[model samples]
Target chain A: MQIEAISKANSPEIACVVLCCRIFIKTASAEELEQFVQAHEMDWDEVYKYAAFHRVRPILYKVLDNCKIPAPVLGRFRNYCRALSVFAFERQVESARIQQVLGQQGIVVRMYKGLDFTKLVYGGDIGMREFTDMDMMIDSRQLPELAKVMTAEGYECSQIEYLRRFPEHYVANKKDICFYKRSPMGKLFGFEFHHRPGNFLMDQSIGFRELLGQDYLHHSAPFSQEQYYRLMLLNHGASDYFPNLRSLVDMALLSQKGIGSVPEQLRRVERLSQELSMRLLDGPAAATPADNVVMRCATRITKLQLTVTLRSVWERRYMHIRFSASFSDTFRMAMKFLHYLMLPNELDINGVQLFSFKLYYLAKMVRCVNFPGRFKKVFSRV
Target chain B: MTQHDIVHRNEKQFMISNLGNEIVLMDIQQGHYINVNPVGSVIWNKLAVPIMVKDLIHSLVEEYGVSTAQCEDDTLKFLQKLQQHHMLNVQ
Candidate 1:
C-alpha cells in the first residue's frame, strides 16, 4: 500500500508502526522500511506508544533493530522485548503445568490464541508475540469439576463468585470465565476458560466438541489450519471488531500457511476485516472484490481509530450493529449495551451490604435516566 | 560429582529460550527464572548433550583463549551453581 494511503486517517507514527510490523511479516521490503522510517522524521515517543498499545512492539523491535535509531530508544525497545520473552516463558511453563494437571483429571483443555499462536505462528519464539493471558477451550459441562481442580491449584474464579450471587445472569450471558492466581514473584497469571469457540453474536456457538471434533480428546493438535484461521477470523475479527494491527498480522501469517479461501459464512464484520487486512498488506489491487460496496465498507472501517477511546467505543458499537448478521443479533447487541449501562454487577457493589444493593440500583437508574443525552453526544461524534 | 564427571541439562525440569544474546531458563517446578549470559549460554547449549566438566573447561579455554586455571575455576563454579539449583544432571 502507498504510505499516504496507510496514514489516511491515522497519524504518521501509527502508519510507521503498522509498516514496521508488516515488514517483520515480510509483506514489505527492508529497503522500503528504511525509506519509510527515514522519510517520516518520526516521533519516537508516538511510535513506541502506538506499537505498545497495539501489542505489536515485539514485531516493531525486530524490524527496527537493524534500522538507524537512537541508542537509548533502541535500548528501551530491547528491554521491552526481553521482558516480554521472560513473561511469555513463564506463561508457557504455567500452561504446561495446568494442562498436565487437567489431563490427569480426565478433563482435556485445548489451548487457543495466546501462547498457542506464539508457538504456531512465531516458531515457538514467544518474544515475537506479547500476550497477557492464556485462552483454553473446555467442555462447558465440566466447569463445576474444573472449578474444583482450579481451586485445588490455588486459582480464584471471580466469575464463579458472581455466579453464586446471580446464577441466572451468568448462565444467560457469559460463555467464559477467567481464573487468576498470583505467582510468588508477584506476577498475576490469568487463564480464560472458553466454552464457546466464538462470540454470542455469531449465528451459533460452535462448541469445543463440534469445532475440535470428539476425537480431539486424544489428539494433540488443537485445530486444523483452516479451522484455526476461521476461529481467528470469527473471534478476533467479528467478535473483537478487529481492534489491532497484531490481529491483522496474525491473519496475514495464517493466510500464508495455505488455509485456502475465506469461509463463505463469515459475518459482515469478518468479511470487512479480511478485506482490510488484504488491502493493507498487498495494496488495493489485492482486494478480491470488484464490488464497490464492500470496498467502501472496508475503507470506512479502516479509517476508525485503532486506539481505545469513548469515540472509538461508540464507533465499534456502530460497526457491530451495522455489520450484524441478523436483525435479532443487532437487537441483542443493543439490549446488551443498555444492560451494561443500567446494571451494576457484583464488582460494582463489592463492599456494599445487601440493603445498599437496592440503593445502588436506584442510583444507577437515576444515572441511566440521563443516558439519552450521553447517547446523543456519542451519535453526534460519529 | 567431580570435575571429571559428565553433566547434562535437566531438560524435564526447565523450559529454555535463547533470546538474542541471553539464555533464559524457567524452572517449571519452582517458577523461578535464571538468565544466563552469553558465555554461560554457550555452556548451556553445550550441555544439551552430556559433557565432562574437564572437557567443558578445555573447550571454553580453546574457544575463549582463557588460561587453563581460570577457565577450569569459572566453569566449575558455574557447574556447581547449576547443580545446586538441580538444573544439572551430574554423573
Candidate 2:
C-alpha cells in the first residue's frame, strides 16, 4: 500500500520529461535560447519550475525561446547555464567533425546520443541534455590514426607522461584529448575527444569489438537508415540508460517512432540490461572466474519468465530508486530476481556472486526447449 | 567591518578561482565555496562558522604556512575587498 501510494504520487515517466527539460533549458545560450523562443511554444510556469531546480535549465529554455538574448554575464548565477550551453553546442559541432573524420578514414562512426539524444529524449519541446564532452568509439586499430588526425586538426593527444605521473584511476578507462584553444574565448570552449566509454572490462565486453556487428531484428524494420543506427540506439541505451528513468523515456520514444515490436525490443533490451547490470556490479577481477556461469545463466532466461523481475524494476517508488546507492545496484538486484523467477539453478563463478551458474543453465535449458534451433551453443569459449 | 580589522587568507579561497584560466568570483553562502582550477575544481568544505579576522589568518598560516604578519595584512585587505562586494560582514 505504501509503495502503491508513492508510485501513484511520482511517475517516473513524468520525472524523466521534467529532468530532460531541466537539462535542456539550463544549457542553452542566448543565441540558442532565442532559437527556442522562435521555434516553439512553452509552458513558462513549468519551464520556471525546471529552472528553479536545475540552474542551467531556465537559461536554456529562455535561449530556445529567444536566441537574440544577449549572452549573460559570466557570473555565478549564469555560469552553470553558460557552461551547459557551451558544452551542448560544442558537443554537436565536435560530433559533426568527428563524423567527417571517421568518414574520411573509411570508418562507419555511428553517432549515439549526439543531437538526436537532446532532441528526441528531451521531447523536442525543451532543450536537451548537455554534456561536456563528445563520446565516439572507433576500431581499436584506428586509435593511432585517429589520434594523429585529431592532433593535426588542433586537438592535442592526452599526454601519457602526465597521466603516469598523476595516475588517476578514472582516466584509465577512457582515452581523451584536451584540444587546447587558440583564442581567449575559444580557450574557455576547449573540447574532449573520448575513445573509450567507461571501465576497461566494460570496454572489452561491450566495446566495438564485442558488438555483434551481426544484424539483429531491427534489420527487417523499415527506416531511412540501416541496421547500424538501431544497434547504436540499443547499445547506447543498454550501456547508459537503465539506471535513469530519463534514458528509459528516450528508449520508449525510440521504440514508439521506430517501426518495430515494442515488447520484443524491450525483451532484447532486458537481456542487454541484465548483462550490463552484471558487468557493472561484478568487478572485473571478481567476475573473471564466474564469467562462464553468468553467461550461461544469462543465455537461459526467457522474457516470459521475467514477469516478477519487470514488476520489481518498473514498479518501485521514486524515493527507493533515487536513493539507491547507485544505478547499477538497483538494476542488478532486479535482474538477478528475474533470472531466478524464470528457471532456477545453482550457478558457480569466482566473481559472479549474484546468480549461480546452475540457475543460468536451467534458464538456458528452458530457452533451448522453446527455440530448439536458435539456442545454439554455450559461450564458454570466449 | 572596519578595513583595519579585516584580514584575508590567500591560501585558496573557493569563492574566487579560475574560469578558463581567468580568476572569477563565485557566490558564497555560509560554508561552501568552489575554486575552479584548470583541470577541474578544488572544493573547500566545512568552513568554520562566524569566520573572524584572527581565525582566518590562523587558518591561512596553518594551511599555507604564510608569515602571521603578512597573513594578517593580506587577510585584512582581502576581507575589505569581500566586504565591499557584500560577500562577508562583521555582524
Docking model 2 quality class: incorrect
For candidate 1, what is the total of clashing residue pairs? Answer: 0
Candidate 2 lDDT over A1-382, as tens digits, reads 1212212444322222233333332321244333434444444444434344333342333333323322332233245544454445444555666678767876544444444445444443222343334444444445455555656776653443333332242244334534544432363334444444432212233433223243321233322222333444444433333433233334344433443322333234444433533332121122123334334433332121111123243333221223223468557545544543453222222112323334445554544464654533533321
Error of 1 at A89 (Å): 2.5
Q: Which candidate is the best by DockQ?
A: 1
lDDT of 1 at B80: 85
For lDDT, the strongest prediction is: 1
List ranges where model 1 is wrong by over 4 Å.
A4-10, A100-107, A165-169, A215-218, A261-263, A267-270, A283-287, A290-297, A305-315, A325-382, B1-12, B36-91
DockQ of each: 0.32, 0.02
